[model samples]
Target: MRLSRPLRALVVVDGTDLHHDLLGASSALRDIVLEGGVVADRAVGADRFVDPLPVTAEADVYVLYRSSTHLAPEQQAALSAAVAAGKGLVVLHSSNLFGFEEGGIDADQVAYELVGSRYVSHGDAGSEGTYTVRVRGGHPVTAHMADFVIEDEYYVIECRDDVTVLADRTTPEGGTQPIVYVREHGEGRVVYVALGHDMRAWGSPHFRQVVRQAVLWAGGVGLDAVASWSTRFPLGNGRFIGPDGGAPA
Candidate 1:
């Protein structure tokens, strides 16, 4: 199945300020193929990744690099414009910086609310400790993730009145943190992953899977979605054992 028009994806790894190799993110994303099929668009999404609007309309996928700048005008404009163009966008950590600065909440609202919480701040290494990422079920993006540990900046994402929270991690207070989330912006769809401070995180298979799914989902791909590694999903252990109470493999 082909994507409807106005759903091409462009992945922008805007690390121009952080001083890291954009090549890895560029290359890894370049390797992703939709539904096991290669395309002229997604393959070259990296090269097409630009700083601002040379990019037409919204891409089915837009991976913006997170930096220290607090929601600069150009950044916000590009993002808003992408949605106006009717596309799907995925923002990594620090990308949230642009939305919020060192201030209180606002009427405009930037912190994404997917489920019912907010992604406020990062977790402290000493008190907040790192841990593994356990998959709740058979989500294509998360199932492949081995419970890995990383002491990254956790968040307090305010659950918007609208949206869905995909994954949640626990915090020092034993409260659940909204890690991955999705919502609609205009006619377009937007998803945010509250991690990826650097390239290493950017390259995780699980991370990549979330991104791929967000791309397809934003492009109007249905619940029966299929990515390269997601032939099996919605993995509920929905089965009865044999005569005896045994596991079903």
Candidate 2:
């Protein structure tokens, strides 16, 4: 359904001494969401880990890119409660790297369950290379998207059986690996994208398109409304201009 007002998004990019470029990733994501006519705000570093805002109070949707080693129990609970109350969640990249044994954290069960998957490994030699991403048809997140190739660190994760895989890649061993997927938790909707390792993946127009649509879908915007918005503000070469012919507000 069309939203009566602009969708508010809380983009969290928090981590300590992380290998991934959190700042760059968050910047790219913010631009993508804003281009889709949504208002985006960021929570970075200590602000997110030490003192976090109430998840439900901050925005209608939560975009997470946390590569940290741990998430506090209270914070995890808050996020769980928010999503259960119908707030949307969009998890990206290493945000799924959480659990007790797998995540190296004390209390991450709630967060782990929320993400619906736990990162296991990429592959031998770090599995960083160019590969094709096949977008699965018939899903809102994969609408109008075609298979594309990208240079990234392909992740291997163990997921719950209930998630619907939207896109995937073939492993060197000729096995199917999920690249994008969605889940439903309580009254909230969740979307997880396994791409976005760094600027190389984010620079891809296809990657940006998937993420933009995922954010919109999680925020409860209907396909027709999303199409209308895309028609008005087409994302060309990752740059989007407002209707007034200036930067997006």
Candidate 3:
């Protein structure tokens, strides 16, 4: 039952953090995944802990973009089960950051195993600047994207050894780190992106293209259609809630 391209996707976001404005992120992700032609189901805040995890089980792909490091065993197993059932997974920026986990389970270990990486550290916050982002090689997820300069939060990703590196970003300190990658787990596929810490990255045309292609590719959709779609359609205007606490108009 391998998931094919343009499959249904379920997004689980952590809504507890008022500062992160995960609600805006959730809305943006829904639109973005939909724009890529995938059926997107929005699961905001605590709804992700629904009993039996019906939404995840029914979907072909699971997307997580939140900062909540706490996951009950049942919640963790549900996601694992989805992947084992041959579904796809797309892990975004904050999903890799497991800070001060409260549960007995090692949150960092769980993230790495599920997403093929975890965020160990990062540069200054709100420090947006132009950086060199390059397509490392000929990976399907990085296809149709080129090396360009973007202004956003640059993350330093620490991924597993076997994960396929797709693209990289040069840090302000002259160090290069993996920004995008994918890995295969059991019968499922996983794509992780360390970019998109804020609205700028989410709104960037190039960033959206890379993420759209990654979502499709991770879902087992052939790249030919995604590449063609990339050329025909522009990215959705996903809203980004800034740190100033004002929502975008």
Clashes of each: 18, 0, 1
List, residue by residue over 1-249, the lDDT tens digit for candidate 3: 122433888877863565466877788878777777778888865345445367766777777887775655566666666676688888888776553566432744554577787666667543456786777646667765667667766576567788988888766667778878888888999998877767777787667767777778777887666544542234333332122232332
- Off by more than 4 A, model 1: 1-7, 19-23, 32-55, 99-119, 126-130, 134-153, 156-159, 227-249
lDDT of 2 by residue, 1-249 (tens): 235677899788877535888888788888877777788887774244335556437688888987876677777877787788888899998888776455463467787788788788987646689999987877677775667788988799888887999999888888888999999999999999998888998877677777878888888887776554542334433333222333442
Top-TM-score structure, candidate number: 2
What are the models' TM-scores?
A: 0.64, 0.85, 0.82
Off-target runs (Cα >4 Å) in candidate 3 are 1-6, 45-54, 102-108, 124-127, 235-249
Q: Model 3: which residue pairs collide?
A: 5-221
Question: How many pairs of residues in model 1 come into backbone collision?
Answer: 18
The best candidate by lDDT is 2
lDDT agreement of model 3 with the native: 0.69
lDDT tens readout by residue for model 1, 43-140: 22222322544443434556554444344344454556556467566666645543345543341243332112334555553423445554444543
Alpha carbon lDDT at 48, candidate 1: 37
Ranking of candidates on TM-score, top first: 2, 3, 1
